[model samples]
Target: MIPLAWYLIFSAALFCIGLFGALARKNAVAILMGVELMLNAVNVNLIAFWHYYAQMRSTPYVHGLAFTTMVFVVAAAEVAVGLALVISAYRRRQTPVVDELTLLKG
Candidate 1:
């Protein structure tokens, strides 16, 4: 049986990688992908905790699984909205690069 600490460490590493991607990427779509990665990392952590600690015989933590499911739903919605916005921006500016979107001048 893999240790809980290992799962947590992996999740933390994934979260940090996602954070770096979100911060370093210039394309809006790439940033959105990074955000998704981060969300997935959180989900992994939640599930791991639920499995290791919440399933105790005394005080079950099944509630954490529910919260994790909600987070997944929210993450899906966020991806939908974010992708829509990226498409809209690309249509308006003809480029997906974040640095080239300075066209607010009328």
Candidate 2:
């Protein structure tokens, strides 16, 4: 079995990469992808901790799985709403670059 620290380090690295992608991009789609990556990293962490906790306590784990499922649901909804807004903005502004949007300046 893999150690808990390995999973933690991997999740941390994944989250950092996602953070960089989100912050260093001008395209709205790319930013959304980055956000998704970050969400996935969180899921990995949750599962890893859940497994370790169950092993240490000699009990079955269910709460972490439930929480992770909720996170997945929330992420899916976020993607749907985020893409819809991005598409609407693109149609109105003819650009999908985040820095070029000024629709809320009024």
Candidate 3:
């Protein structure tokens, strides 16, 4: 069986990449993508932990799976809302770069 540390390391790397993208990018869409990536990383961690702990207990793994599903649902909602706002901002301001949105007028 694959080791748990490997899964954790991979998830950590994914999270770091997402964090960097979110922090370094100026485009709202890119930032949203980064946020999605980070959320995915979190899902990965949750599944990995669930798998690792599944052996220790006889209980079903639905708890972790359900939580992961909820995370996905929330992420989708967040993406939809975030993109809608970005589109609205772009329509009014003509720029997707976040730094230009100082005044919430648009």
Candidate 4:
């Protein structure tokens, strides 16, 4: 059986990579991709913990799975809304770069 520590390490690395991508990228789409990656890392950790918890309790509770599903739903909604805003900004500003689309600047 794979150890929990290994799963945690992998998830942490994935999350850090996502964080870096989100912070370091200039494109809005790339930032969205990074956010997706971070959400996936969170899913990984949730599933890992759920598996361990089930093993310890010797029961198949579905709370973690349900929470993960909700996260997926939320992530999907976020992407939809975020992309719509980005597209709107791109249409108005003629650019998708995060630094250039300064709609908030008055």
Estimate every model's Cα lDDT from 0 to 1.
Answer: 0.89, 0.96, 0.92, 0.95
lDDT score for residue 101 of model 2: 93
**Candidate 2 lDDT trough over 10 residues, lowest sum:** 52-61
Question: Which residues of candidate 4, in runs, are more than 4 Å off?
Answer: none
Off by over 4 Å in 3: 103-106
Deviation (Å) of 5 in candidate 4: 0.8
For model 2, what is the error of residue 75's alpha carbon versus the real structure, in angstroms, after optimal superposition? 0.3
Clashing pairs for model 3 are none
lDDT of 2: 0.96
Candidate 4 per-residue C-alpha lDDT over 1-106 given as tens digits, one digit per residue, 9 for 90 to 100: 9999999999999999999999999999999999999999999999999999998996799988998999899999999999999999999999989999889999
Model 4: weakest 10-residue lDDT segment is 55-64
**Per-residue error (Å), model 1, residue 63:** 1.2
Better of 1 and 2 by TM-score: 2
Arrange candidates, best lDDT first.
2, 4, 3, 1
Tell me the tens digit of each residue's lDDT in model 2 across 1-106: 9999999999999999999999999999999999999999999999999998988887797988998999999999999999999999999999999989999998
* Residue-level lDDT tens digits of model 1 in 1-106: 8899999999999999999999999999999989999999999998998887754657785777897999999999999998998898899989999888776657
Candidate closest to the true structure, highest lDDT: 2
Could you give candidate 3's per-residue lDDT for residues 75-96 as a string of tens digits?
A: 9999999999999999988999
